[model samples]
Each structure stands twice: as structure tokens, then as C-alpha cells.
Target: MIGRLNHVAIVVPDLEEGARVYRSTLGAKVSEAVDLPDHGVTTVFVELPNTKIELLHPHGEGSPIAKFLESNPSGGMHHVCYEVDDIIAARDKLESDGMRVLGDGEPKIGAHGKPVLFLHPKDFMGTLVELEQV
Candidate 1:
């Protein structure tokens, strides 16, 4: 089962500009950009009182984010991550309930260095859902 809201990911065409908007305009505390080659994204986390906002940029031509940006040129909300006590259990439960998991149905190390899984967007009302182990 899902736990607390982990973070909301937003795809951006420019990672630096996205971080700048959060840091300067919104006056938020932004973390340094980190390149996640496995995930094919360069990310910046905007810290907040309750949760974090993740700004993601495509890291390579084959990056999924690159494909997403091609469809949504200006970039947009990519996914909502929720915490889970046990990612495998959550994945099994969701699978049994008829929800489709993405990417070979295995957990991958996420930005927080926690195991994570992504569910199909169509199953979750057109919104991509990410489940991260807490």
C-alpha cells in the first residue's frame, strides 16, 4: 500500500532554469542537480516543509523524459511518487488488483536511493504513479 506523498516530479526542458525558478522566484531551497544515468534524467529537488518537488530533465536522446518532452514540448507534470513500507508487497497488491506496473515490473533505485516502481498512467486516471519504498 502507498504511504505518504514522496514527491511530485515535473519534467522541464531546462533543468537549471527550472531550479532557478524554484530557488529565486519561489524562494525555495533547491538541492544541487544530480545526474541519474540509469534513469536518464538530471534532477533537482526543491525542498519544502512537507514534501519535495523534483525537477527532471532528459539526460540523453533515448531518455524517457526526452520522449515525454517531445509529446509535451514545454514539459509538464511527469509523475507523483508515494512512499510504501514494502515496495514488493505494494507491487504485488497493485498487480493483483489489476494495475499494470511499468518496466519489467521490477523496482529500481530512485532519486532518494530507495527502491521504486512506476505504475501505468492509464490505470491511475492518466497520471503516472511512482511507488517508493520508505
Candidate 2:
């Protein structure tokens, strides 16, 4: 089952500008950009009192974010990540409940270096859900 809200991911055309808006304009604490080649994204984390906001930009032409940006040129909320005690168990439970998991249906290392899995957007009321092991 899902735990606390981990982070909300937002796809942005430019990571720097996204960070700037959160940092300088909003007066938020933003982390340095970290390139996640495996995930095909360059990310910046905006620290918050309760949760974090992740700013994601396409790392390559083949990046999934690039594909997302094609449809949503302005970029927007990509996914909402929730923490789980056991990712594999959570995945199995969701699967048995008829929820479809994305990708190969396996956990991948996320930005926080934690195991994470993505669920189909349609399964969760049109919003993509990401489960990260806490």
C-alpha cells in the first residue's frame, strides 16, 4: 500500500527556468540539477516543509519527457510519487487489484536512489502514479 506523499513531478521544457521560478521567485529551497541519464531526465528538487517538488526536463531526444512535452508544450504535472514500505508487495497487490503497472513492471532506481515503479495513468483516474519504496 502507499505511504506518505513522496514528491510531485513536473515536466518542464527548461530545468533552469523551472528551478529559478521555484527558487528566486517563490523563495523556495531548490537543489542543484542532477542528470538521470538512465531515466532520460535532468532533475531539480524544490525542497518544501512537508514534501518536495521535482522539476524534470528531457535528457535526450528519445526521452519520455520529450514525448510528453510534444503534446503539452508548456509542460505540466507528470506524476505523483507516494512512498511504500515494500515496493514488490505493493506492485503485486496493485496488479492483483487489476491495476496496470508501467514499463517492464519492475522497480527502477529513482531520483532519491530508492526503488520506484510507475502505474498506468488511466488506472489512477488519469493521473500517473509512482510508488517509491521508503
Candidate 3:
């Protein structure tokens, strides 16, 4: 079902500052912020040797990240994405095992433009897990 670790998403109050920290301080390669209206987030990716770190900021009032920021204020780890060879098959197996999938229980186009599904945090030791099809 789960394959490899893809990327770790971090919610940031300021996308530019976050990317700057990763770029200047950590000396990482950061991408320009991209607004994803559908996902309701403006994101910047910090490319790495193995995986990536996604810095996300709320893009709109209705964004889920907006609600997250309200409580967190400083923002924090949003979710960890893992790759799956076959997302549909993995979803079915997880569902049969009683794991709850978020967002209509269907895969959506994620930040990577790949089919992705989020599983309930409670089901995965209090961590929101994203399954992305490879």
C-alpha cells in the first residue's frame, strides 16, 4: 500500500519567509510560490536530494489552512505525504481495514499534480497521512 516517503508539508503564516529560511539559512533550493486556488494554498517547494519539503500558506478565506492557522497561529506541520504504486488499490485495502479517508473518500489532484488521498489522523497515530499515486 504505502510506498516511499514523498514530502512533508508545513503550514506557514508567511510563505516567503518560510522559503527564505529554507533557502538562505538551510541553503536549500526553493521554488517560487505557486497559488493553487483549487487546493486553496500558495505553496513553495524546497527541493532536496531524496524528497521535498512543501511550505504552504492559506490562499483564500475558505482554505482549510486558514482554519489551521487560526488555531496554530504560528503554523506547523500540515501533513506527510507517502507515495503509493496504486492509490485506488491502497484506498480500497485501507477502507476495508476500517480506515477513514478524507474529502469525499476520493483521490484529488494534489500539490504534485498527482492523485492523492488523505486518511484520518486518528487512524495513523495522530498524524495526517497523504497517499499519492506514483
Best by TM-score: 3
Please provide, for model 1 over 1-134, each residue's C-alpha lDDT reduced to its tens digit, 9 standing for 90 to 100: 67799999999988889999999999999999999888888999999999999999988668878888989888899999999999999999999999999999999898778998999999999999999998
Instruction: Please provide TM-scores, in order, for all candidate models, with all chains considered together.
Output: 0.95, 0.95, 0.96
- For candidate 2, the lDDT comes to 0.92
* Ten contiguous residues with the weakest lDDT in model 1: 59-68
Off by over 4 Å in 3: none
Winner on TM-score between 1 and 3 is 3
Error of 3 at 59 (Å): 0.5
The global Cα lDDT (0 to 1) of model 3 is 0.92
**RMSD value for candidate 3:** 0.9
lDDT of 3 at 57: 95
Per-residue lDDT of candidate 2, residues 1-134 (tens digit) = 67899999999988899999999999999999999888889999999999999999999658878889888889899999999999999999999999999999999898788999999999999999999998
Off by over 4 Å in 1: none
Q: RMSD, each candidate, Å?
A: 1.0, 1.0, 0.9
> How high a TM-score does candidate 1 get?
0.95
